[model samples]
Target: MKKLPLIMMGLLIFSLVPYVESASVGKASIDQVMLSLGESVTFGDYKIQFADIDQAWTQALIKVYAKDGSLVTSKVLPTGYSLSVPDNDNPLFYVRLAWILRSNQKILISLESELELVEGDVQINKNDAYNLPYKFNDVVIPAIKVKVTNTYENKANVRIVLPYETITATIFEGDHYAVPYKLTSDFQYFPYLYLYLKNATTSYAVFDVYLPKYPTTVFQLGEGGAGGTTPSAPGAEPTELVYNDIMYEGENLIIDINGTEYALGLNTVGYYSSFTLFDKDNNPLKSFEVKKGTGYELSEAPLVVELINYESEYKRAYLRVYAPRGTEVAPIVRDPKIEVSVSTSSTELLLNDELLVFINVENSGRGRADNVNVVASIPTGFELGSEIGTWSLDTLNPFTEMPVLVYLLKPTQVGKYELGPVVVKYYDERGIEREVDSGNPLSITVYAIPKLSVTGEAFNGTWGTYVHTQEKT
Candidate 1:
């Protein structure tokens, strides 16, 4: 039995040794390494070589090779420019040229391996510990551990345990704490761990943590070209407008330009896709065929319609409509739908009587309403008595209602009068100013008091008035 226990222990130790040896220690990184022409330096599986330099010394050709001595990539890197190995999107490493010295025929460059960043959200109970795993290329390495020690009132106390030291921090909701840690055996410390407390309760807490597998180095290059002006590099594309929604077949996209509403409709027949422009009354103005991923400008208007993609089975077309020639074109999208209501304390009142008017506004859409201005029309027979004619609000969030706007109005002349259709002007989330009316007007009736007068003559039909003790009949 004793020999059997020892054999099992030996087998367990043998199983863990290969896994420890197979784990990667750290990422390869070098900075400001000077290499002469045809000279190469090896970093892990990739080798960087200074292949050739142009006669003007403005550009140099660099080549990268894999460990099997096979060429991987060749790029002519300009001074002060960088080349990402493999490609820019999923770059394994980066090669940045610092400067070219004609005097010594040498090029200064730097190589840095991409750091692997891992981020996730963890929900932990109070006094429970969560181990944060550091991964490099999907292989787990040594990392720190975090424990939620205490949580009170919207704040959480956490303890971070590293291989060398431990740290404690008190963080509120939406607060983040960054701790320096070493991912490898090397002493280089990096702010490799980030803890963000998203929400915390008395019994439990939710937080997000960000961990990087390796440390990084930032290099500052000197000014290049004449007068410290860097020439524009090639392969930079201009930014194009992106479309968010996919329009279905037979759908209309309405655009408003300088008080005119132009409707653009898309319809596909067989293999052909056509966009038709129509007036506000649905009268067709012009129609043109647009290919996929191509832009077609309307001859009737100064607008361009780009077809991003088309799905025949789903009858959907992804399109982007804009003004290509710098013409101002505003597309009519879903905005903050604001509805207003106006009410009064009493519909009928006497002359000089004040009427209490209440105006309420609500946003029923997903967009926000900004710079809202409410203008109550003062009728011909009434005048404002208390508040100003216009009321302003800085912002009204979506699905929210503003406080009732109250104003007093006194009837100037006694007659049947119409009170309101309060005009509301505001800017939507797109900064486009829009106007809306209450639509329902309040009808009010003001009555004037009757006057009674009597006169008596003392001289009996002589139209002369005499007082004292004598009574006139």
Candidate 2:
């Protein structure tokens, strides 16, 4: 029994000896070696290579220091002269084993052949090449990576709104134009990356890429532009034209609304005799005429304004007003749809830090605005601090206009921005969710003014002021 056990132990040792020797010697002798970082490099006539299945090989050791060392990897190859090194840092190696001579099939026994370690510290050169005195124990590779980020808003889907009746005239010349328009406070647009490359202490190049241009439309609906037009009332008495109460100095009968001030076409000196004078009480008074000492009288008092009829093609709207019957006011039509017209007192502004967005809500349709919910939806990346009160309009107040204000945060980047389908989703007269009207889309363009800084002294020369190339000692 003891002899049988000893014989079994010897058999096991004999079975492992050949496998261990295979690392130092193979069926054939190595003729050439080509180490690749992540793939196998082809050697002349034969292809001896190995690859990492689960791990990467960062360093490799070849048996021969210059051309004599021979080292084999964990895997064996039938006929090849190459090895594949991975791109990550992991200790792995491969050895080439081929016949240097083909005449005789004499297998050479490479005894205890191990890859030689580097003698001194390795150094890398700028030419992307290396001058190593000794061979590496394992192949080393650098990790490559790719990354991308989205910095632009959806441009093609953005909607831009213009003020009502505001004509945005753009003359395209040479395939480009600089157009100007007002932007709503809730505007949010795409942002692009600006790359700059500099060599040493000098700038080399700058790259400006317009991410993408989004689709946009004019004004929130029923305000101005292609929509919002209607015919004037036939035989309708002229409503008192109450200009904003803002007045300018120097006895000028002009009133400033918003930011613009306008004057009556004629002087207001005693023109009220032919003109009719009426008070809010609908009572007529002769003293209301523009006397020699009296300047222009107040055109009209606070009146409820509403959009009665809207004509899209003419871009006009008819308004019904309950005015005092005593004023001899000439009803001048300013609208293109009718002889009467309207001039807006609104101005476009680029607010970088803060802005006040105003939304006016009214019911133009014949249906009563019961439970009318006007929702102002802003774009992403914008913040609404708090919900200001509703337009304080009574359901009983017929033909009423209510104003809602929203404060907008300034944008960091410059571009065209858009906010909402100002949705006016409310139940119609039948208590059904039947209305699908949208407030006008608004557009705002954020811009940046670049600043240039000059350093050091100057010298006047022909080359547009010679600059010092180097620092003074």
Candidate 3:
């Protein structure tokens, strides 16, 4: 009976071991949770609470605490902004305020952790090797070399040669194999390389490699002996490396020089291949079309690319790229100037007379004006007779004038009035709102009609007697 109890106790202890281990290393995430003021939630080893909110709700106060009941940080987070734990450069946890609902007195926040990804796909033929480079500080070194030994239908044999050891595996289609590696002496052995076989044929095989993390420092190999040193000599400048790689059409080859990342994309493959260079933001910096065995130099950015060879069957191009200088470019910005004028058909008019008003809007600047609106003001004694007071155009190009906007107005009362300084509102190309008005208001005069009555009493009434004036006057 005692032996049975002992066995049960041992099994219970073993079961709890994995649970404790998993909890210690597990990653925590919370997707967009709505929390009210003074609400709190616990995730992994951390606790997050919504402490307070401002009256305008534009900002919120958030408090974070560790599992040991100790406060980690208290921050005032703004809408559309985020607060990263331990700073942004090496963030382990993130507390982002997506938005706030003013009507409900609740806030939407998300807690997340940064994910480490180092995955890519490569195609290699039998007996060919692909080199993966590791960047430590400013020094670049060849970290691993992957070679294809053999390939059959749906399976390929690969050899992963590392600095310390070599590993071999047979990967079938849709399956993967992980190889353990240590980037530096201070790190533990992790699954640094994963080879996922996408397709395997007699000639070649395609693999998707995943490297979750890379070492910040590496062992240095020397002629005299093997020793550890800093990435480079003291006060020594970082050096650039020429990277050689093979890529198919639409595939991107990434290179980093002097902490700036550049991507070379093969747009088309032919006798005359075309490639485009992009910055880290994927903005095209330059483009080139060169024949095989020729090179191109980008003047805007200090980079050179040379095409060595192309395989028509595989649609792959072997390329060599390097950055020898710094980038030299400037951005150009243009402004839009709007001019408005108001004109009247006649300055002087009689009562109950109709007048035609014309509004001319023009863009005289170098940029285009968007969402142009023209507004006309009616005089005090005049009423709008034809068309509305407002006119709109989608866009007014530079040095362009819109069609004439004509409206009619009738004078309701006889008086002198001023017809208006028309107003124009528009947005520039940079989404800036601008307002412009006509230089001066147009003057108008309304005069009353003149009435003339001629009453001629031509009477030869010099005397009271009325004589027969047939002959004698």
Candidate 4:
């Protein structure tokens, strides 16, 4: 029984050893933030590299040093199916992503890493073979990496041909690209390597590879006029994975989450998708027009926004905002259609008589209205009263109406005056502010007040000479 337990313990540790991290855990946390660029630090099995930030006064892009593998949220196997990285930190790391706001304040971050301790560091020299010195405990170093630089003006297709190995490279002009190559056998001695650069498609030798009669090099598509092929690198394996060129999607307003596209900010309303849309950053736009091609930048990353309409026909909804792809959201339907009507107490106004104006505004749609204001433009002949011909309401429920009355008096000698159409502005079901034209211009006639003169002919059957109080009545 004792022997069996010991055997089991040995097997358990052995299994864990392969996945067990070979590096040391290290972290450097500070209250202050560094604003300089090109700063770097190494700890445990990780190296953090920071580049200059242009968009912000003090910002840095922290890149973790991981070659050929990724740091996941947990110690689980890489299942490339799920697009989301769990918002966890363990074997994986999570960077702090924040809201859509800009300020002059500074931010501080503490970077942590796991780096493998080595007796010596990796190195490469100019015009010579790579000198990668790796140390292992009494065993052989299994892998080596070399990054070749482009010394020419145009970006040429580079191929590394070595012992039983073949690798093609696509690097920016005058920039260096790294390649990791594994060895079949343990490192016994230094091996020779060869490099070749040529036109990518034509296989035409733009320049002859300067092989130091040491390591051999790579192969390509076109062989005509190109340098002779040396022996392939050792233990070379053909790869199904794509390298060299990067693929980009078209302008369908799609946000690229990793390599896949997650489309947003559209609905099934087809032609009715038109509404005043605001981005996560910018405020309400001037143009009220909405169309398929319209877009605003919310962020360069994958994020969703909660949108609340001020006074539109559509209800408040969460939208994955960005340039929209072909996919769309549900159509816009005015649940509570709003309508406004206007009328006058009397079409004709007698001279020295006041006029009463009545306006009936209703919410006919299914949704509610928050802001509703009615204003009447005074006719040229009439003077405005204390109300200023304006009435405002805070809210109007669907299928409800509010009546308003405005009194106007002192018509400036009106012959025939036409009052302007009343304007009713309110938010529709979507919280979109929209104004409706009420009744047409009102026409009124102002005639002088009639004068009545009465003479008492009964001046008296009696007191004829009585003092006739005939005064100006």
Which candidate comes out best when scored by lDDT?
A: 1
Ten contiguous residues with the weakest lDDT in model 2: 335-344
Candidate 1: give the clashing pairs. Answer: none
What's the lDDT of the predicted structure labeled candidate 1?
0.64
What would the per-residue lDDT of candidate 4 be over residues 19-138, giving only the tens digit for each residue?
222233221111112222343333223333333232433222334443333542221111011111222223322222111112312222222112223322222222223423333322
Model 1, runs deviating above 4 Å = 1-45, 48-62, 98-119, 134-136, 149-159, 162-172, 175-191, 212-473
Error of 2 at 372 (Å): 1.1
The sequence of per-residue lDDT tens digits that candidate 2 reaches over residues 4-61 is 2344335334322111212321122121222222223222111222232111211122
TM-score of each: 0.33, 0.23, 0.31, 0.26
Which prediction has the highest TM-score against the true structure? 1
> Which residue ranges in model 2 land beyond 4 Å of their true spot?
1-352, 391-397, 436-440, 455-457, 460-473
Runs in model 4 deviating more than 4 A are 1-335, 388-390, 452-473
**Best first by lDDT, ranked:** 1, 3, 4, 2
TM value for model 4: 0.26
TM-score of 3: 0.31
User: How far off is model 4, as Cα RMSD?
Assistant: 26.8
Deviation (Å) of 49 in candidate 1: 4.6
Error of 2 at 194 (Å): 66
